[model samples]
Structures are given as structure tokens and as C-alpha cells.
Target: MFLTNTLIVLATVAGMEAFAWLAHKYVMHGWGWGWHASHHAPRSGWFEANDLYALVFAALAIVLIALGTSGRWPLQWIGAGMTLYGALYFVAHDGLVHQRWPWRWVPRSGYLKRLYQAHRLHHAVHGREGCVSFGFLWAPSPTRLRAQLQAAQAQRRAQPRQAPPQRPPQADTRGR
Candidate 1:
């Protein structure tokens, strides 16, 4: 039973990648852009409003741990998984890719390189919209993502353009 619980925790950690992907796409880029924008845009300082999302997730994990200790639910494992995943994300994203810290190592391996490039593609977008590679821990090959972005741009460009609204002719007031 203990092993089963551990398995569940591990599974939850893996699943958090997908959960993060969706949340980054919909919530962070959509409704939560007010905070998340600070991340995509140029840096003004060492921190960003986007860091609030981390705090929110940490608070949730604390709540879950408290409940689990109180015997209210089996949420401790889930919370632990989320915390571990968050740490991994911070290392990969903040430390390696974005270089928010002093860590300067670059990825030479295949998967790590893909992860790094995919994130570069994500930041290639000018704003929250029309962005790709939402998942921090996982992403498609950079070539594939680039093709998708190009395809989307082509589709938008191929669409018919709307004509400008015509203004009514003004009266000949100068003659009067």
C-alpha cells in the first residue's frame, strides 16, 4: 500500500506537466496574462508579477499537506508531487533556459536542446496571443513548432482583407 501511494505520487508529478501545459496556454496566456505578461515582456527587474503564480501553487501545496496531516484526505502525496515538479520546472525554466540565475550551462543533448529551443519559440511571440510551446517541461521539436507557427501565420495572411469604411462626401463648404 505504501508503494502504491508512492506510485500515485510519481504519476501525479508526471501528470503535472500536462496540467501545466494547459494552464500555461489557457489561464496564464489568457485570463492570467495580467500577471504572466511580466514574464513574456522585457525584464524591468530581477523579479516579475508572474512569480505570484508560484506563490499561489505553493500555498495550495501547504494547504494540502495540512489537510493530509490532519487525516482529512490523502492529499499529501499529491502535494509532494506538485512541489517536486515545481522545483524541476524552476531549474529547467528559470535557471537553465531563461538564465534568471547565474547558472549558464546550455543543453547539448537532444531532448534538452529541444526543450531549450521550444521555449525560445514560445518567447518568439510578441505577446501572450499567437504563442506556441506552452509546456515548460515538454515541447515538440523546434522544427515542428516552427512549421506550425509559420502555417498559422500563412493562414492568417491568406485570409481576405476587409475594406476600409468609406466616409460620405463632405458638402462644398469652401465655395460658400
Candidate 2:
């Protein structure tokens, strides 16, 4: 039972990375931008509007935990996994990367460096549309992220802009 619960927690944590990537790419960047836009801009106070997402996820975890405590199996573990993921996200995304916390140590090398670089590249775009590196815990190589960003920018540039409709010339009916 212990091992099974532990495995569930581990799997859930891993699964969250993939889920977060998809949500970050589609929801956060798409229709949900009204809330997520705060993250892209300079934060005015200690909290940004984007923090609502954390609250939503935290509420979900709380509910799952409550259900589990009420007798449902595995839910507690899943909730624990989510809580753990949130903590990790806080440390990596908010603390290490964004310097939201007092500790401002930049990663000198290794996976931390890659993670740092990938997220930085994500913000390389001006708006929400062209960003890359959506995942929080997992990040691709910096080179690959850079190439993808460049390709997306080039694609945008290659597309022709539509000209405004022109008014057709009318006959001189007033003279008649």
C-alpha cells in the first residue's frame, strides 16, 4: 500500500509537468490570457493577476485531499503530488528564474541553467502569441527553443498583411 501510494504521487508529479506544458501553451496563451497577461508584464505588487491560476490549482488539490480523507483511495496521494508540484514550481519558476524571492542566485550551469535559459527565451517575445518554452519543471534545450522562436517570428514576418478595402469610383450622376 505504501509503495503504491508513493508511486502514484511520483507519477502524478511527472504527469503534472506535461499537463502544465499543455495548459501553459494553450489555455494560458490562448483564451485565458485575460488572467495570464499579468505574468508577462512587470508585476506591480507582490502578487500578479496570474497568481489566480495557482489558487485554482491549489483549490483542486485541497478538494482532492478532502475527498481522500473522507475515504476515497489514491486521491490524497494525488493531492499531495499536486501540492509538491506547486512547491517545486514556486522554487523554480518564481524564485530561481524570476527572482521573486530574496534568493537571487542564477544557475551557473547544468539543468538549472537550461531551465533558466528556456524560460527566458519564452519571454523573448513581446506578447503572449509568439512565446515558447511553456513548461515549468521541464524545459527543452535552449538552442531548440531559440530556433523555434526564430522560426515562429519568421513565419509571422513571411505572411503578407491585408490591405484595407478601397472605395470604388462612382459615376458623375449629380451633373446629369
**The candidate that achieves the highest TM-score relative to the unseen native structure:** 2
RMSD of every candidate to native, in Å, equals 3.1, 3.0
What is the TM-score of each predicted model, taking all chains together? 0.88, 0.92
The C-alpha stretches of model 2 lying farther than 4 A from their native spots are 164-176
lDDT of 2 at 79: 97
Best by lDDT: 2
lDDT of 2: 0.94
Candidate 1 local Cα displacement, residue 53, angstroms? 0.7
Model 1, position 65: C-alpha lDDT score = 77
> What is candidate 2's TM-score against the reference?
0.92
Q: Positional deviation of 65 in candidate 2, in angstroms?
A: 0.5
Give the per-residue lDDT digits (tens) of candidate 2, residues 87-160: 99999999999999966899999999999999999988977888989999898999999899989989999999
